[model samples]
Target: MCDGYVQCNIVALPEAYAADFARFCALNPKPCPIIGQSNPGETNVPLLGDFDIRTDCPKYQLFVDGSPTAELQDIRDYWQEDWVFFGLGCSFSFEDALLQAGIPLRHIEQDRNVAMYNTNIACQSAGPFSGNMVVSMRPLSVAHTIRSIQICSRFPAVHGAPIHFGNPKDIGIDDINKPDYGDKVEIREGEIPVFWACGVTPQQALRAAKIPCAITHAPGHMLVTDLRNAELATL
Candidate 1:
Protein backbone atom coordinates (compact mmCIF):
# COMPACT_ATOMS: atom_id res chain seq x y z
CA MET A 1 0.00 0.00 0.00
CA CYS A 2 2.94 2.33 0.45
CA ASP A 3 4.39 4.05 -2.57
CA GLY A 4 7.15 6.02 -0.89
CA TYR A 5 9.15 2.99 0.17
CA VAL A 6 11.67 1.17 -1.98
CA GLN A 7 10.09 -1.15 -4.54
CA CYS A 8 11.97 -4.33 -5.52
CA ASN A 9 12.17 -6.51 -8.59
CA ILE A 10 11.03 -10.07 -7.90
CA VAL A 11 12.28 -13.38 -9.30
CA ALA A 12 10.83 -16.76 -8.36
CA LEU A 13 12.09 -20.10 -9.57
CA PRO A 14 11.99 -23.71 -8.50
CA GLU A 15 14.36 -24.91 -5.79
CA ALA A 16 16.07 -27.03 -8.41
CA TYR A 17 17.27 -23.83 -10.09
CA ALA A 18 17.45 -21.44 -7.15
CA ALA A 19 21.12 -22.10 -6.38
CA ASP A 20 22.24 -21.16 -9.85
CA PHE A 21 20.09 -18.06 -9.78
CA ALA A 22 21.57 -17.08 -6.44
CA ARG A 23 25.05 -17.43 -7.90
CA PHE A 24 24.01 -15.37 -10.89
CA CYS A 25 23.03 -12.57 -8.53
CA ALA A 26 26.27 -12.92 -6.64
CA LEU A 27 28.22 -12.62 -9.83
CA ASN A 28 26.25 -9.59 -10.97
CA PRO A 29 25.49 -7.71 -7.79
CA LYS A 30 25.21 -4.38 -9.51
CA PRO A 31 22.08 -5.41 -11.36
CA CYS A 32 20.92 -8.27 -9.17
CA PRO A 33 21.57 -7.19 -5.61
CA ILE A 34 19.62 -9.55 -3.39
CA ILE A 35 17.65 -7.66 -0.76
CA GLY A 36 15.44 -10.53 0.42
CA GLN A 37 14.72 -14.14 -0.44
CA SER A 38 12.09 -16.70 0.56
CA ASN A 39 12.49 -20.29 1.56
CA PRO A 40 11.40 -22.90 -0.90
CA GLY A 41 7.63 -23.11 -1.14
CA GLU A 42 7.20 -20.10 1.15
CA THR A 43 5.83 -16.87 -0.26
CA ASN A 44 6.77 -14.77 2.74
CA VAL A 45 10.02 -12.81 2.90
CA PRO A 46 10.53 -11.97 6.56
CA LEU A 47 13.14 -9.35 5.73
CA LEU A 48 10.95 -7.22 3.49
CA GLY A 49 7.62 -7.53 5.36
CA ASP A 50 4.62 -9.70 5.97
CA PHE A 51 3.31 -10.04 2.46
CA ASP A 52 2.31 -12.85 0.14
CA ILE A 53 4.72 -13.06 -2.75
CA ARG A 54 2.10 -14.40 -5.11
CA THR A 55 -0.33 -11.59 -4.47
CA ASP A 56 1.73 -8.68 -3.20
CA CYS A 57 3.31 -7.60 -6.45
CA PRO A 58 1.20 -5.64 -8.94
CA LYS A 59 2.44 -7.49 -12.01
CA TYR A 60 4.46 -10.59 -12.98
CA GLN A 61 6.08 -11.98 -16.08
CA LEU A 62 5.78 -15.72 -16.65
CA PHE A 63 8.51 -17.37 -18.68
CA VAL A 64 8.33 -20.86 -20.12
CA ASP A 65 11.62 -22.46 -21.12
CA GLY A 66 13.20 -18.99 -21.18
CA SER A 67 10.69 -17.24 -23.40
CA PRO A 68 8.24 -14.78 -21.87
CA THR A 69 4.88 -16.52 -22.16
CA ALA A 70 2.45 -14.22 -20.45
CA GLU A 71 1.87 -11.22 -18.23
CA LEU A 72 -0.39 -11.75 -15.25
CA GLN A 73 -1.73 -9.49 -12.55
CA ASP A 74 -1.48 -12.24 -9.97
CA ILE A 75 0.54 -15.49 -10.09
CA ARG A 76 -1.50 -17.59 -7.72
CA ASP A 77 -2.18 -20.16 -10.40
CA TYR A 78 1.51 -20.53 -11.23
CA TRP A 79 2.73 -21.08 -7.71
CA GLN A 80 4.69 -24.23 -7.10
CA GLU A 81 5.55 -25.95 -3.84
CA ASP A 82 9.25 -25.85 -4.67
CA TRP A 83 9.30 -22.23 -5.76
CA VAL A 84 11.74 -19.82 -4.10
CA PHE A 85 11.30 -16.10 -4.46
CA PHE A 86 14.16 -13.61 -4.62
CA GLY A 87 13.70 -9.91 -4.02
CA LEU A 88 16.28 -7.78 -5.83
CA GLY A 89 16.81 -4.12 -5.02
CA CYS A 90 15.44 -1.86 -7.73
CA SER A 91 16.68 1.48 -9.11
CA PHE A 92 13.52 3.18 -7.86
CA SER A 93 15.05 3.53 -4.40
CA PHE A 94 18.00 5.52 -5.68
CA GLU A 95 15.75 7.44 -8.03
CA ASP A 96 13.94 8.72 -4.97
CA ALA A 97 17.22 9.71 -3.39
CA LEU A 98 18.23 11.54 -6.55
CA LEU A 99 14.96 13.46 -6.70
CA GLN A 100 15.24 14.42 -3.04
CA ALA A 101 18.72 15.78 -3.67
CA GLY A 102 17.28 17.99 -6.47
CA ILE A 103 18.73 15.80 -9.24
CA PRO A 104 15.97 15.82 -11.80
CA LEU A 105 15.10 12.55 -13.54
CA ARG A 106 13.86 12.94 -17.07
CA HIS A 107 11.90 9.69 -17.06
CA ILE A 108 9.81 10.75 -14.07
CA GLU A 109 9.47 14.25 -15.42
CA GLN A 110 8.11 12.92 -18.69
CA ASP A 111 5.83 10.44 -16.89
CA ARG A 112 7.66 7.49 -18.44
CA ASN A 113 9.67 4.56 -17.23
CA VAL A 114 13.44 5.04 -17.34
CA ALA A 115 15.08 4.00 -20.57
CA MET A 116 17.00 0.72 -20.35
CA TYR A 117 19.29 -1.06 -22.77
CA ASN A 118 21.19 -4.32 -23.01
CA THR A 119 24.87 -3.49 -22.88
CA ASN A 120 27.74 -5.41 -24.44
CA ILE A 121 29.29 -5.71 -20.99
CA ALA A 122 29.26 -9.43 -20.22
CA CYS A 123 28.38 -10.71 -16.78
CA GLN A 124 30.20 -13.53 -15.05
CA SER A 125 28.27 -16.70 -15.75
CA ALA A 126 26.96 -18.79 -12.91
CA GLY A 127 25.82 -22.25 -13.94
CA PRO A 128 23.24 -21.83 -16.67
CA PHE A 129 22.86 -18.13 -16.00
CA SER A 130 24.74 -15.90 -18.42
CA GLY A 131 23.80 -12.69 -20.20
CA ASN A 132 24.89 -9.19 -21.09
CA MET A 133 24.45 -6.46 -18.52
CA VAL A 134 21.36 -4.27 -18.71
CA VAL A 135 21.30 -0.65 -17.65
CA SER A 136 18.80 2.14 -17.03
CA MET A 137 19.52 5.62 -18.34
CA ARG A 138 18.84 9.09 -16.96
CA PRO A 139 19.88 12.31 -18.63
CA LEU A 140 21.29 14.91 -16.27
CA SER A 141 23.49 18.00 -16.34
CA VAL A 142 27.21 17.58 -15.63
CA ALA A 143 26.78 19.07 -12.16
CA HIS A 144 23.81 16.85 -11.28
CA THR A 145 25.67 13.82 -12.57
CA ILE A 146 28.35 14.23 -9.92
CA ARG A 147 25.76 14.87 -7.23
CA SER A 148 23.77 11.80 -8.24
CA ILE A 149 26.83 9.61 -7.99
CA GLN A 150 27.51 10.89 -4.50
CA ILE A 151 23.93 10.42 -3.36
CA CYS A 152 23.33 7.02 -4.96
CA SER A 153 26.60 5.61 -3.66
CA ARG A 154 24.93 5.53 -0.24
CA PHE A 155 22.40 2.93 -1.41
CA PRO A 156 24.38 -0.09 -2.53
CA ALA A 157 21.48 -2.42 -2.01
CA VAL A 158 19.61 -0.61 -4.75
CA HIS A 159 22.34 -0.40 -7.36
CA GLY A 160 24.84 1.85 -5.58
CA ALA A 161 25.95 4.25 -8.34
CA PRO A 162 25.99 5.16 -11.97
CA ILE A 163 27.98 2.72 -14.12
CA HIS A 164 28.32 4.83 -17.27
CA PHE A 165 27.57 8.39 -18.27
CA GLY A 166 27.84 10.60 -21.37
CA ASN A 167 27.95 8.89 -24.77
CA PRO A 168 25.46 6.00 -24.92
CA LYS A 169 27.48 4.44 -27.74
CA ASP A 170 30.32 3.85 -25.31
CA ILE A 171 28.09 1.18 -23.75
CA GLY A 172 26.84 -0.20 -27.11
CA ILE A 173 23.62 1.77 -27.03
CA ASP A 174 23.21 2.85 -30.65
CA ASP A 175 20.41 5.34 -30.16
CA ILE A 176 19.41 7.50 -27.19
CA ASN A 177 15.72 7.35 -28.07
CA LYS A 178 15.70 3.61 -28.74
CA PRO A 179 15.90 1.49 -25.60
CA ASP A 180 15.86 -2.27 -25.27
CA TYR A 181 13.49 -2.01 -22.33
CA GLY A 182 11.31 0.70 -20.69
CA ASP A 183 10.18 4.02 -22.21
CA LYS A 184 12.50 6.68 -23.63
CA VAL A 185 12.82 10.10 -21.99
CA GLU A 186 14.19 13.37 -23.29
CA ILE A 187 17.86 14.32 -23.14
CA ARG A 188 18.51 18.04 -23.22
CA GLU A 189 21.48 19.46 -25.12
CA GLY A 190 23.58 20.14 -22.06
CA GLU A 191 22.57 17.00 -20.19
CA ILE A 192 24.59 13.82 -20.42
CA PRO A 193 23.00 10.38 -20.24
CA VAL A 194 23.81 8.45 -17.07
CA PHE A 195 23.41 4.70 -16.79
CA TRP A 196 22.88 2.48 -13.75
CA ALA A 197 23.03 -1.29 -13.45
CA CYS A 198 19.41 -2.38 -13.70
CA GLY A 199 17.45 -5.08 -11.89
CA VAL A 200 16.47 -6.58 -15.24
CA THR A 201 19.70 -8.57 -15.34
CA PRO A 202 17.92 -11.63 -13.95
CA GLN A 203 15.27 -11.35 -16.58
CA GLN A 204 17.96 -11.48 -19.22
CA ALA A 205 19.49 -14.46 -17.46
CA LEU A 206 16.14 -16.15 -17.42
CA ARG A 207 15.92 -15.75 -21.17
CA ALA A 208 19.39 -17.13 -21.58
CA ALA A 209 18.82 -20.09 -19.28
CA LYS A 210 15.59 -21.17 -20.95
CA ILE A 211 14.46 -23.05 -17.92
CA PRO A 212 11.11 -24.82 -17.95
CA CYS A 213 9.40 -22.18 -15.88
CA ALA A 214 10.41 -18.93 -14.21
CA ILE A 215 8.70 -15.83 -12.89
CA THR A 216 9.86 -12.24 -12.52
CA HIS A 217 8.36 -8.83 -11.91
CA ALA A 218 7.25 -7.05 -15.04
CA PRO A 219 9.61 -4.24 -15.96
CA GLY A 220 8.80 -1.09 -13.91
CA HIS A 221 6.03 -2.82 -11.92
CA MET A 222 7.97 -3.63 -8.78
CA LEU A 223 7.10 -5.16 -5.44
CA VAL A 224 6.33 -2.35 -3.03
CA THR A 225 7.79 -3.45 0.28
CA ASP A 226 7.53 -2.16 3.85
CA LEU A 227 11.22 -1.25 3.84
CA ARG A 228 11.74 2.49 3.59
CA ASN A 229 13.98 3.96 0.90
CA ALA A 230 16.12 5.62 3.59
CA GLU A 231 16.65 2.28 5.30
CA LEU A 232 18.46 0.98 2.21
CA ALA A 233 21.17 3.60 2.44
CA THR A 234 24.44 2.14 3.75
CA LEU A 235 26.07 5.49 4.40
Candidate 2:
Protein backbone atom coordinates (compact mmCIF):
# COMPACT_ATOMS: atom_id res chain seq x y z
CA MET A 1 0.00 0.00 0.00
CA CYS A 2 3.01 2.29 0.23
CA ASP A 3 3.22 4.06 -3.11
CA GLY A 4 6.22 5.84 -4.69
CA TYR A 5 8.58 4.05 -2.33
CA VAL A 6 10.58 1.09 -3.56
CA GLN A 7 9.16 -2.40 -3.04
CA CYS A 8 11.31 -5.56 -3.02
CA ASN A 9 10.94 -9.33 -3.15
CA ILE A 10 12.72 -11.24 -0.40
CA VAL A 11 14.83 -14.36 -0.83
CA ALA A 12 16.60 -15.75 2.24
CA LEU A 13 19.11 -18.50 1.58
CA PRO A 14 21.61 -20.41 3.64
CA GLU A 15 25.25 -19.22 3.61
CA ALA A 16 26.23 -22.17 1.45
CA TYR A 17 23.88 -21.06 -1.34
CA ALA A 18 24.18 -17.29 -0.90
CA ALA A 19 27.01 -16.81 -3.40
CA ASP A 20 25.28 -18.82 -6.10
CA PHE A 21 21.95 -17.09 -5.51
CA ALA A 22 23.67 -13.72 -5.84
CA ARG A 23 25.20 -14.93 -9.10
CA PHE A 24 21.80 -16.09 -10.26
CA CYS A 25 20.42 -12.57 -9.77
CA ALA A 26 23.36 -11.03 -11.60
CA LEU A 27 22.80 -13.39 -14.54
CA ASN A 28 19.03 -12.87 -14.70
CA PRO A 29 18.73 -9.24 -13.72
CA LYS A 30 15.45 -8.64 -15.52
CA PRO A 31 13.61 -10.88 -13.06
CA CYS A 32 15.99 -10.86 -10.11
CA PRO A 33 17.58 -7.42 -9.83
CA ILE A 34 19.32 -7.12 -6.50
CA ILE A 35 18.73 -3.76 -4.82
CA GLY A 36 19.92 -4.67 -1.38
CA GLN A 37 21.40 -7.68 0.39
CA SER A 38 22.59 -8.53 3.89
CA ASN A 39 25.56 -10.50 5.11
CA PRO A 40 24.99 -13.94 6.55
CA GLY A 41 23.28 -13.78 9.97
CA GLU A 42 22.54 -10.07 9.56
CA THR A 43 18.95 -8.89 9.84
CA ASN A 44 19.50 -5.29 8.75
CA VAL A 45 20.36 -3.90 5.34
CA PRO A 46 21.38 -0.32 5.99
CA LEU A 47 21.01 0.58 2.34
CA LEU A 48 17.27 -0.16 2.28
CA GLY A 49 16.09 1.13 5.68
CA ASP A 50 15.99 0.51 9.36
CA PHE A 51 14.13 -2.76 9.58
CA ASP A 52 14.42 -6.31 10.78
CA ILE A 53 14.37 -9.00 8.14
CA ARG A 54 12.49 -11.32 10.43
CA THR A 55 9.45 -9.06 10.83
CA ASP A 56 9.47 -6.36 8.12
CA CYS A 57 7.44 -8.07 5.45
CA PRO A 58 3.71 -8.63 5.88
CA LYS A 59 3.94 -12.31 5.02
CA TYR A 60 6.55 -14.97 4.27
CA GLN A 61 6.43 -18.29 2.48
CA LEU A 62 8.41 -21.20 3.85
CA PHE A 63 9.81 -23.75 1.45
CA VAL A 64 11.26 -27.08 2.44
CA ASP A 65 13.19 -28.98 -0.20
CA GLY A 66 11.71 -26.67 -2.89
CA SER A 67 8.09 -27.23 -1.78
CA PRO A 68 6.15 -24.47 -0.10
CA THR A 69 5.22 -25.68 3.38
CA ALA A 70 3.57 -22.77 5.14
CA GLU A 71 2.67 -19.08 5.16
CA LEU A 72 3.98 -17.10 8.08
CA GLN A 73 3.26 -13.69 9.55
CA ASP A 74 6.61 -13.42 11.27
CA ILE A 75 9.82 -15.41 10.88
CA ARG A 76 11.67 -14.65 14.09
CA ASP A 77 11.52 -18.21 15.34
CA TYR A 78 12.36 -19.61 11.94
CA TRP A 79 15.36 -17.41 11.27
CA GLN A 80 18.62 -19.24 10.70
CA GLU A 81 21.87 -17.72 11.85
CA ASP A 82 23.77 -18.43 8.65
CA TRP A 83 21.09 -17.29 6.22
CA VAL A 84 21.57 -14.25 3.97
CA PHE A 85 18.74 -12.08 2.66
CA PHE A 86 18.50 -10.58 -0.81
CA GLY A 87 16.07 -7.81 -1.70
CA LEU A 88 15.23 -8.02 -5.39
CA GLY A 89 13.63 -5.10 -7.17
CA CYS A 90 9.90 -5.64 -7.66
CA SER A 91 7.42 -4.77 -10.48
CA PHE A 92 5.39 -2.70 -8.02
CA SER A 93 7.97 0.09 -8.31
CA PHE A 94 7.32 0.55 -12.00
CA GLU A 95 3.52 0.40 -11.57
CA ASP A 96 3.74 3.83 -9.99
CA ALA A 97 5.45 5.15 -13.11
CA LEU A 98 2.67 3.73 -15.31
CA LEU A 99 -0.08 5.18 -13.12
CA GLN A 100 1.62 8.56 -13.13
CA ALA A 101 1.96 8.44 -16.91
CA GLY A 102 -1.86 8.35 -17.24
CA ILE A 103 -1.83 4.73 -18.34
CA PRO A 104 -4.59 2.82 -16.55
CA LEU A 105 -3.62 -0.60 -15.24
CA ARG A 106 -6.28 -3.31 -15.45
CA HIS A 107 -5.42 -5.10 -12.22
CA ILE A 108 -5.34 -1.81 -10.27
CA GLU A 109 -8.64 -0.73 -11.80
CA GLN A 110 -10.17 -4.13 -11.02
CA ASP A 111 -8.62 -4.09 -7.52
CA ARG A 112 -7.00 -7.47 -8.00
CA ASN A 113 -3.44 -8.69 -7.82
CA VAL A 114 -1.74 -8.44 -11.22
CA ALA A 115 -1.91 -11.60 -13.32
CA MET A 116 1.37 -13.59 -13.39
CA TYR A 117 2.36 -16.62 -15.45
CA ASN A 118 5.28 -18.97 -15.95
CA THR A 119 6.85 -18.53 -19.36
CA ASN A 120 8.94 -20.76 -21.62
CA ILE A 121 11.80 -18.22 -21.48
CA ALA A 122 14.77 -19.95 -19.87
CA CYS A 123 16.93 -18.16 -17.31
CA GLN A 124 20.71 -18.41 -17.38
CA SER A 125 21.78 -20.95 -14.79
CA ALA A 126 24.18 -20.10 -11.95
CA GLY A 127 25.14 -23.05 -9.82
CA PRO A 128 21.82 -24.88 -9.27
CA PHE A 129 19.57 -21.85 -9.85
CA SER A 130 17.92 -22.54 -13.16
CA GLY A 131 14.30 -22.39 -14.39
CA ASN A 132 11.88 -20.79 -16.85
CA MET A 133 11.12 -17.12 -16.34
CA VAL A 134 7.92 -15.93 -14.62
CA VAL A 135 6.14 -12.81 -15.81
CA SER A 136 3.45 -10.38 -14.65
CA MET A 137 0.89 -9.26 -17.23
CA ARG A 138 -0.92 -5.97 -17.76
CA PRO A 139 -3.54 -5.52 -20.46
CA LEU A 140 -3.26 -2.10 -22.05
CA SER A 141 -4.11 -0.34 -25.27
CA VAL A 142 -1.52 -0.31 -28.03
CA ALA A 143 -0.81 3.38 -27.52
CA HIS A 144 -0.39 2.99 -23.78
CA THR A 145 1.73 -0.12 -24.22
CA ILE A 146 4.24 1.87 -26.25
CA ARG A 147 4.30 4.65 -23.70
CA SER A 148 4.72 2.13 -20.90
CA ILE A 149 7.80 0.78 -22.60
CA GLN A 150 9.33 4.25 -22.67
CA ILE A 151 8.43 5.06 -19.07
CA CYS A 152 9.40 1.68 -17.61
CA SER A 153 12.65 1.56 -19.54
CA ARG A 154 14.00 4.33 -17.34
CA PHE A 155 13.70 2.07 -14.31
CA PRO A 156 15.74 -0.95 -15.32
CA ALA A 157 16.23 -1.89 -11.70
CA VAL A 158 12.49 -2.52 -11.47
CA HIS A 159 12.19 -4.92 -14.42
CA GLY A 160 12.76 -2.19 -17.10
CA ALA A 161 10.14 -2.74 -19.87
CA PRO A 162 7.58 -5.13 -21.31
CA ILE A 163 9.37 -8.21 -22.57
CA HIS A 164 6.45 -9.30 -24.76
CA PHE A 165 3.05 -8.11 -25.91
CA GLY A 166 0.07 -9.26 -28.04
CA ASN A 167 0.13 -13.07 -28.25
CA PRO A 168 0.16 -15.17 -25.07
CA LYS A 169 0.90 -18.34 -26.99
CA ASP A 170 4.29 -16.95 -27.99
CA ILE A 171 5.26 -16.96 -24.32
CA GLY A 172 3.94 -20.49 -23.60
CA ILE A 173 0.93 -19.02 -21.84
CA ASP A 174 -1.96 -20.99 -23.30
CA ASP A 175 -4.81 -19.27 -21.43
CA ILE A 176 -4.95 -15.54 -20.79
CA ASN A 177 -7.66 -15.76 -18.15
CA LYS A 178 -6.10 -18.50 -16.05
CA PRO A 179 -2.83 -17.30 -14.54
CA ASP A 180 -0.42 -19.43 -12.53
CA TYR A 181 -0.18 -16.79 -9.80
CA GLY A 182 -2.45 -13.89 -8.74
CA ASP A 183 -6.02 -13.24 -9.90
CA LYS A 184 -6.87 -12.93 -13.57
CA VAL A 185 -8.11 -9.55 -14.76
CA GLU A 186 -10.21 -9.27 -17.91
CA ILE A 187 -8.33 -8.16 -20.99
CA ARG A 188 -10.57 -5.57 -22.61
CA GLU A 189 -11.53 -5.88 -26.28
CA GLY A 190 -9.02 -3.35 -27.67
CA GLU A 191 -6.18 -4.07 -25.28
CA ILE A 192 -3.49 -6.75 -25.46
CA PRO A 193 -1.59 -8.51 -22.68
CA VAL A 194 1.84 -7.05 -21.96
CA PHE A 195 4.24 -9.04 -19.84
CA TRP A 196 7.14 -7.91 -17.61
CA ALA A 197 9.76 -10.04 -15.93
CA CYS A 198 8.68 -10.70 -12.36
CA GLY A 199 10.53 -11.02 -9.06
CA VAL A 200 8.70 -14.28 -8.31
CA THR A 201 11.07 -15.96 -10.78
CA PRO A 202 13.46 -16.73 -7.96
CA GLN A 203 10.92 -19.01 -6.36
CA GLN A 204 10.70 -21.03 -9.54
CA ALA A 205 14.49 -21.24 -9.65
CA LEU A 206 14.53 -22.30 -6.03
CA ARG A 207 12.13 -25.13 -6.84
CA ALA A 208 14.33 -26.29 -9.70
CA ALA A 209 17.43 -26.21 -7.53
CA LYS A 210 15.65 -28.15 -4.79
CA ILE A 211 17.45 -26.30 -2.01
CA PRO A 212 16.94 -27.76 1.44
CA CYS A 213 15.27 -24.63 2.76
CA ALA A 214 14.34 -21.32 1.21
CA ILE A 215 12.24 -18.40 2.41
CA THR A 216 10.57 -15.88 0.14
CA HIS A 217 7.94 -13.22 0.34
CA ALA A 218 4.50 -14.53 -0.55
CA PRO A 219 3.19 -13.50 -3.95
CA GLY A 220 1.72 -9.96 -3.91
CA HIS A 221 3.23 -9.43 -0.47
CA MET A 222 6.39 -7.30 -0.72
CA LEU A 223 8.83 -5.56 1.57
CA VAL A 224 8.43 -1.79 1.48
CA THR A 225 11.63 0.21 1.78
CA ASP A 226 12.46 3.85 2.47
CA LEU A 227 14.22 4.31 -0.86
CA ARG A 228 12.17 6.33 -3.33
CA ASN A 229 11.46 5.09 -6.85
CA ALA A 230 12.92 8.23 -8.42
CA GLU A 231 16.29 7.44 -6.85
CA LEU A 232 16.52 4.35 -9.06
CA ALA A 233 15.59 6.04 -12.35
CA THR A 234 18.07 6.40 -15.21
CA LEU A 235 18.81 9.67 -17.00
Best by lDDT: 2
List the pairs of residues colliding in candidate 2: none
Q: For residues 14-105, could you state the per-residue lDDT of candidate 2 as single tens digits?
A: 99999999999999999999999999999989999999999999899998899999999989987899999999999888999889889999
The true-versus-predicted C-alpha distance at residue 113 of model 1, in Å, is 1.2
Local distance difference test, per candidate?
Answer: 0.90, 0.92
- Candidate 2 RMSD to the real structure: 1.0
* 23-141: candidate 1 lDDT, tens digit per residue: 99998899999999888999998789889999988999999999998999999999999999999999888988988888778778878878899999999998889999999999889
Q: What is the lDDT of residue 49 in candidate 1?
A: 88
Q: In candidate 1, which residue pairs clash?
A: none
